[model samples]
Structures are given as C-alpha cells and as structure tokens.
Target: MTSTPTTRNPPTSTASSLLSVEGLRVAFPGRRGAPAARAVDGVDLDIGRGEIVALVGESGCGKTTLARCLLGLVPPTAGRVTFDGAPLPRSARALKAYRRRAQLVLQDPSGSLNPRHTVYDVVAEGLRIHGHAGDERTAVAEALSRAGLRPPERFFLRYPHELSGGQRQRVVIAGALVLEPELLVADEPVASLDASVRGEILALLLRLRTELGLSALVVTHDLGLAWNIADRVAVMYLGRIVETGAVEQVLTAPRHPYTQALLSVLPEAPGAPVVLSGEPPDPSHVTAGCRFHVRCQILAGGEAERAGVADACRHRELEILRGGDAAQVACHWARAEQPAAGTGDAAVGRRPN
Candidate 1:
C-alpha cells in the first residue's frame, strides 16, 4: 500500500472557472437539542469550462447536498456559489435565467420521469417553462438526438413505460439538454441502470461535453466511474473535501488516509485492502481536530509518534495542505514518508490478522 507523493495541476483561474464554490456550508437543524447536522462543511471547488469533475464518496457524505447547493436547490448556511464569475441569482426572474444554463440529471430515471407524460412532453417541459417552447418540437427532437436517441421523432409520443431503462435515462438527459445548459450537475447518473447501460450513459455525457462543450459535476460512490469519465476527482469525507487532484493521480496514488483505504479495497488493488476499524463519523456531531484521526491508520499505527506529530493529530485542526505537485491532502502526516512494513499496530495499509 505504499505510495509516493505526486504533484497536482491546479484548475484554471477563478475568472475562467465555469462554476466555482467557495467555503460552502449547509446545515440542518437537529432534533431533541442535538447539534445541527452539517451536510457540507466549508467546501471550496472549481470546475473549468468543459471539465468533468467527479465528487466521490460513500452515501451520506454530503455529495448530494453539495450538488444541490451548486444547483440552488438547497440554500447554503454559508459560503458562495458562482457561475461565469457572478454570484448565484437571487430574484425569481434571474434565477430562472440562471437555471436555463445549469441543469441537473438525477440518479433515478424511472422515478424522475412522469409515467403519464410522453417523451416529447417530458423534454419540452423545460423549454415551455423557460419560454423557449415556440419551436418545442424541433428543440425536443434535437435534444433527444443529442442524448443518443437517434431518429428522436420515432420515440416522441412514447410513454416512460414503453422505453428501455437506458432509453428512459436518455429521456431524462434529453430533458436537461433541451435547456441547452452550459453546466450539468448529474447526481449518480448511472447508479440505477444495468451495468451494460451504465457505459452507454457515461459515453453520452462525455460526447455532450466534447460536442457541446458542457461542464459537469458528477456525484457518485463508484470510483471506477470517476476514472472512466471524470477529468478530475474530489474525494469527500463527512462534508469536506479531503483529497482532490487529477483523476489519474488521485485514483492511482491517493494521498489521504481515507482515499488510500478506499483504493486498497478495489478488486485489482496492489495489496491486501486496508480496512478502517470504525464507521464514518456522524456529521451532526463531528469530532474535533482531524475528523478522520480517530480511524487513521498512520496515527493509530504510531507513525505520528515517529514523526513527533501525534499530539497535533489529536488536538490541532489540519487544513487542506499540499502534499505533492498536484495533490492536496487534509492530514497532518500526509507528507511523511510511508512507514516501513510492520512498523506499527495501526493497520493503516495492511490486511487484518
């Protein structure tokens, strides 16, 4: 499980970023006097024009909440989200205009599509709402064609129940495409489809980016999907980004303890999977200092003692720090050379006895 430090190439400048989120936070009030649940805690992110960035994490890590914030579907407790160098729209009229440029592709096509509506109606609904319905037929057919449903008119009058799972998903994408959006925030876009269908949908997304020059923020728990399509990867833990870098670098040689543990478990991983001992921490009552310290193999294995940073790992809050040329890791000991095999009892990158 040993890995060397690697450099990360930063994304384009803020002015050039198609979408930017700074210090974003979202919290829900807790019940019974408990602390508020912080779904997204101080996340900062940027997506360049035509870039596909995958937000990867386990369920409940707040990837969806972060996406919602970017979509203006949920209001953030704090922080700012911007598009094309301007703050998100506030008034109803302005927001409507903003939404036309940024659309969402949901995870479940079956649940998202109205069973009663024809495909034409589903795709044209956005055009009608945005005042582009005058040429609805043309726009609907074009969008459906762009989504890989060639000869789109043939399916125009078909209902959701009549389409294959893949075609239904394409209809959902067609609905988003009808708006001619510049940015698409797709939340687990392929999770519900068959494995065979998953590749088709992903290829469509990439084609849209190449042909239409669209940028996207895809949220998912599957690291393989990120490797397949995303240009960059942001690994989320709890509500914060713990590691982010170019997809090849982050997936091949992750820097964060959490990232390493995750990759170690992949089927073709180099070593026996590194298994952490506890469940992920609750967002409502996040621990102080490094949120992952309680389960970190390096700290648990006493590598921190060797580095003389054990105290810092338990008390001092660590910021997202540069670990290599292109990678940023949020850990006090990330830069330390990997501990020699059998160095500590931490089980950081070792199989269970």
Candidate 2:
C-alpha cells in the first residue's frame, strides 16, 4: 500500500533552455512484411542551461532512443533538434564538432570502458582526437579530479579490471569531462553501481552542474532518482510525453492517468498500488485512440461513462493539454475538466475510427 505524500515547493529554473527537440521521431524498418517499429514518436522536450531534467518511463518506452537522438548517435526519421539556436549539423565534420560539446555517459561502466586502456589513456583519448592534447597529462588529471577521483595521479595507471565498479564508472565520467562538454546525456549513470556508491555518483553529477554550470538530460526508469535530482520531470508513455512540469508538481499532483498510476505504486504514496491490467502496447502495433485507455483505472471506474465520453475514449486520439501554470497532461477526462487551458472545443472532440 502507498503512504501519504507530502507536498514540496516546485523546483525553479531561471536559466534559458539550451537544447530544444521538436516533434522528434525515430522508426526502425521491419523485415518479413512486418510494420516498422516506432521507437520515439512525436516527442517534444527542452533542457535548460545549467539544469538537470529527468526522462522517466518504463523500459521500451523510448527514453534511451530519445537521448541517443539528442547526441546525434541515431538519426531521426522526422523532426529537428536544435542546440543553442542552431539545427544539428548534417556533415560529418560539423557533427563531430557538435559531439565534443555534448558528451554521453553510458549505463554500464564495465562494458563501456576498454579493459586494455589505463584510466589516463581513456580520458585523454577524446583530447587527442579533438587536437587538444598539448598537455594530455594535465587534462586527464583535472578531469579525474572533477569526477571526484582525488589524487588523480594515483588512478592514472589503473586499468578497468584493476579498479572497483565505482572507480571504473568515475573513469568513464572523467572521459566525458575531458571534453568540457556543455551537455551530458547520461543513460542510467548509476544503475550498475552498488547502493552505497549510487549516492556518490549522483552527488558527483549534482556537483558538476553546480561547479561547472553544465546541463544534463538523465534517462532512467527510477522515479526516486527524478525526485532526488531533477529540476523538471518529463513522463513518457508509448513513445510520447504524456505529462511534464516542475518535478514536484508532476510527482506530487500528477494530472494524467498514466502519471497517476505510476505515482500510486510509490511506497510513500497515499493509496493502494494501481496495478495496470496488461503490458504496455507494442510499438509496432499501437492502438487507434488513447494508447493508455486499455489500462487506465480512471476510465474503467466510470469517469468516461459519467461524462458520456466513453465512446470517444475508445476511438479518438488525445493530445497533450495544458493545465494551470506549469502542467501538461494527455487524457480526455483531464482535458474535459480544464477546457479553457487547451485548444478549441475540438481538443476534446471524438474522432471516428
């Protein structure tokens, strides 16, 4: 059962956003007469300069795909990504330069690091590639220090196999830091470390943002992590952001049925767990209307029936609707309650399939 939830003041961010993604979509072509798989579909997001935004969702919901697109590791099938007012460059040379300004930290340090390369070599590799290796030793040492590995010289000669899990992860972070990137897209940065080490790594990330003025987009399924660090939260479901707002606002008073169901499972939440009826819909075979209606408790509990919108819930597509000053939710019932906040009357209208 969930516990009572206490309200916290909403997180505030004054910095201007540096990364903007508009209507991003990524589709993998299928084989043997199957339909294409849509990994990321019509996602819109923004990360403020010097801010930390958490991308929270279940597995296969496209959090990592969205992060990879921002890093230019995966080309989008549609939409555009802009950094600091300019679109992502298409040429290899220009893209390479862009990469140096935005680095990625993978989830598994053991798999991402080279067993053959020492800590110093791993960190200095980026510098060498970017022609900034005039003082390789000094650069590597500084990066290690910044990543919370003190007495950087002591770790310089140690290889991946010789270090602890946490230390190896630090080395991976140091490699990203060597480039002095403005944005860091970390995919589950602490998922592989020990419980004791997780806080240390998260603390290191917070410190980096504080001391270096870095912006980050952390992709994780852990809502606790979002509460612990993010200035804002974006909730993804079936390849779209169904809810987004200040971390506290979204977590404490979630508006969408999907977001509410997720929060209801938290140990400290003040109700019984909202057990979803079935697995998430397959990306290649998404439903016609509200993708979440099949598993939504609110709809099943008679919200749609009471409003005479049950038929619409099963046949009409829903769009993200704004509410109050800082929340957005995509649900027919939510839209009906706050009609003035969304678009025309058609915003909640039914579409026959």
Candidate 3:
C-alpha cells in the first residue's frame, strides 16, 4: 500500500507546533462496571521545531502514556494529536509515514535491543522496514556517527552483549536516526545509564537537536535533566499539567504546590523537601473538582484557608496552562499568591475557576 498524508488541522495548536496535543485522553476499560482507568486525561502540550520540551512527573503521572500518544503508539480516548499542523492519520499507510517522521527512544536499552542482532542489523532495520532506496551502508554509518558511536564500522558486527550500556543506547538512537526522524519522544532517555553516561547521552540529544534541527519531547521525573536540556518544562500531577513555563522559570520558581513538593527534594533546592502525606496522586481514579485538593499541601498546611480560597480550591477544576511564554500554574492558591505579590491574575495565566 502507498503512504498518504492527512490534511486535517486541529484548532488547538499554533502554526509553530512541530508536534502538539490538545485535551488528549487515553483510558483503559475496567472490569465489572468499573470506570475506565484514564492514563492520560486532559493534557495539552506542544514541541516546536528544533525545540526540546520536557514532560516532568513522578511514576504513573501519565508521562509515558502521553509520549506514546504523541508517537501514535497509543490512541487517545478523547481529544487529538497533531504533527506538523496535521491531525494523526487514521489510515495505516498514513500512520506508517507519520512514524517515519517521528520516532521513540525507550527507557531501557538492554530490553529494546535484541541480543541476536548485530549493531549493523539493528541500525539498518528501520531502513529495511521502510524500503530505503538509498545506499544502506552509508545511511547506517552516518546515523551511527550522529549518535556518537565513533568509527561506526567497528560496531557493525558487535552484538548487544558486546557493547557498553551507553553504546547500546547509542545503537538504539542510531536505529531511529536511520530513518532521519524530525522528532524524538525520548522516555527517560538517561535513567538507566550510569551518572557519567547520563550526561553523555543528554549531550548527544542536545547536539542532535542543534545539528539536525530535530525537535524532542523528553519525558522524565528528573527536573535536573529538564534543567540541562529542555527549553520548556511542563510539570504534571495526576494526569494533568499543573505548571508550565520556560525551564528556568518553572524549575527555579515553581508555583503549583505539586511542583513545589517535587522540587523541594532536589539536593540544591533552597528549601527542604516537602514531605507529602496521604495516598500518591493517580489518574486512574480522578475525582471531581481539583484532583490535587486532597493531597495539596497548601490546603493541608492551612495556607489556602488563610488566603480565603480553600473553598474554591476544593471545588474548582483548573484549566490547562495556556501555551506560550508565560509561566503559568493551574491553581487557585497561586492566583491568590499573585495578588499579594502584585503580579495579579494575569501574571499566573489564571483561568476561570
């Protein structure tokens, strides 16, 4: 079958978006009359061409699900995902073509690479799958070089077990690069590597972006990683983005309590780590009103009550952070704090609550 393009353009994104998602939701069915588990609920995100956006959150906060949705590996239950100003293709052929333009780098390299396949075969697999008409050896070599594997020919006969952890990851990246994707959705790209190797992998990603003009959506729980590479950071809680802004602004001066609690634990954090009580935040069983209300330190620590916004905090569901350059926090308490600091509602991108 021949590949085709979809002309559908969603109303949710700006023209600058290389990849965007609007109100995206993905849910899994529950047994015995139970409500489905919504892994990704009401998310809005964008990654511009040549820009790196980090999606930061703890485990089960839907970071991976959202990444999967963006790559079309998992379909959203509601809302839409767009690439290059076009909606995700519905046809198989179109999807295949879209995938060639956008690729994924998984968290674990050992599991992602097959032990039986040589490095040459692994990197050349995508070219073979896509039926590349160009010279295979040259394409493979260039990809390997781009991924930082020096003298790419030396690794051609190496198996997965023959390489170091970082080398295996570079091979995985080379595999994706064989297709010359425009975007990469890297899920915890450095988590599995040694501390020393982590920086190397990150540097490789940054270099790729600069040299190839590639866009990336880096999904990780490490704010430190986001600080190092991402131009922007979106801090997620439960299943929604609670705060977003330029990486420096959001990481240095996070407004959402959820974000604050997350950053407090950093070794260099000015304040001590916030010890959160009660159950962990989960998207599978989201409730009405503010999903973070029950666990919110602002409410529990009596800050919201003192600000006279406790009632609103408990009942109002905040909208997604508006896109663009503004540093926004989707919390009533943040708005309340803004007034005291003379920043006002407009400063926080406060929406109707």
- Candidate with the greatest TM-score versus the true structure: 3
Which tens-of-lDDT digit does each residue in 1-353 have in candidate 1?
22231222344444678888877889999999999999998787888888888899988889999998898889899888889989997777898899999999999999999999999999999998988846779999999999999899899999999999999999999999999999999999999999899888988998898899898999999888888888788899999888876788788877678888888887768888888897888999888788788989988989877987788888876653221123466666774554323533231221111
lDDT of 2 by residue, 247-314 (tens): 87678877778888888888888879889898899889878778788888878999877877777778
What is the alpha-carbon lDDT of model 1 when measured against the actual structure? 0.82
lDDT of 1 at 208: 90
**lDDT of candidate 3 at residue 96, scale 0 to 100:** 89
- Candidate 2, 319: how far from true, in Å? 2.5
In order of appearance, the predictions have TM-scores of 0.90, 0.90, 0.92
Model 2, which residues run further than 4 Å from truth?
1-15, 320-325, 337-353
**Candidate 3 per-residue C-alpha lDDT over 1-353 given as tens digits, one digit per residue, 9 for 90 to 100:** 01121121112224687887777888988888887887877887777888888899988888898898888888788987888878999788898899899999999999999899999999999999888999999999999999999899999999999999999999999999999999999999989999989878988998898889898889999988888888888988787888887777677777789988988888877757888887755555786667789988889989999988899888877876555545677888877775325445554654332
lDDT for each candidate structure:
0.82, 0.81, 0.82
Give the Å error, residue 132, model 3. Answer: 0.6
For model 2, the run of ten residues with the poorest summed lDDT: 1-10
Q: Candidate 2 local accuracy as lDDT?
A: 0.81
